[model samples]
Target: MHSIAFRLVAEEEEGRLMAQRVERRKLRDTINPFELPQSLFEKYYRLNKPGFQYLLDVLTANTEAPKKAFAISPIAKLSACLRFLAEGGYQTGVGKDCDVSNKESCM
Candidate 1:
């Protein structure tokens, strides 16, 4: 009888611990309350798009006079990508499951 009661208590403790573990995992999936603003994502896309478009514009701007703007026209896309890479492009190893280096080249 005593052994049965001890086993029941142990089983209840195990069940409670399992429930806490599940709750912790759910909380882990939640976003941090002190994270960056959502507006930042909008700005990030906007900034990259314009810079990327500008780079393409210059690239296809003129086939006739490649020598004219051949050197550099003060664009932003390549620079931005390079800059982002330099500034740690898409971190993943520490905690994330995806990083830019794993999928995309810096250039």
Candidate 2:
């Protein structure tokens, strides 16, 4: 009886450890809009650098992530939004181009 009880407790502990384990996610690579040439940047996002900067400044507060680790930058978020608007593609496709995950794109 004692051996059976010990085995059950061990199983319970194993289950708890399994429950606490988090799945590792692959971090997608995001494009840097600033790295693009002026014409390309305008063509992709439909906004000039200055205009994009202005919008970023205006929307930074709302777009900023609370934590830096594993958090997307405000610029990346804005670029994703602009790219979505400019291309008029499905969110997943645009997000893929912008290096955003499908789950984040849905949000």
lDDT agreement with native, every candidate: 0.44, 0.68
Candidate 2 wrong stretches, greater than 4 Å? 1-30, 62-65, 90-107
Q: What lDDT tens digits, residue by residue, belong to model 1 across residues 1-107?
A: 99999999999999999999876544333422114244542243334444545655676675343365324322323433434554466342223322212322213
Pairs of residues clashing in candidate 1: none
Give the per-residue lDDT of model 2 (tens digit) for 1-107.
99999999999999877665422223233346776779878887889999999999989755545575656567767887888888887564444453333335434
Candidate 2 TM-score to native:
0.54
TM-score for all predictions?
0.32, 0.54
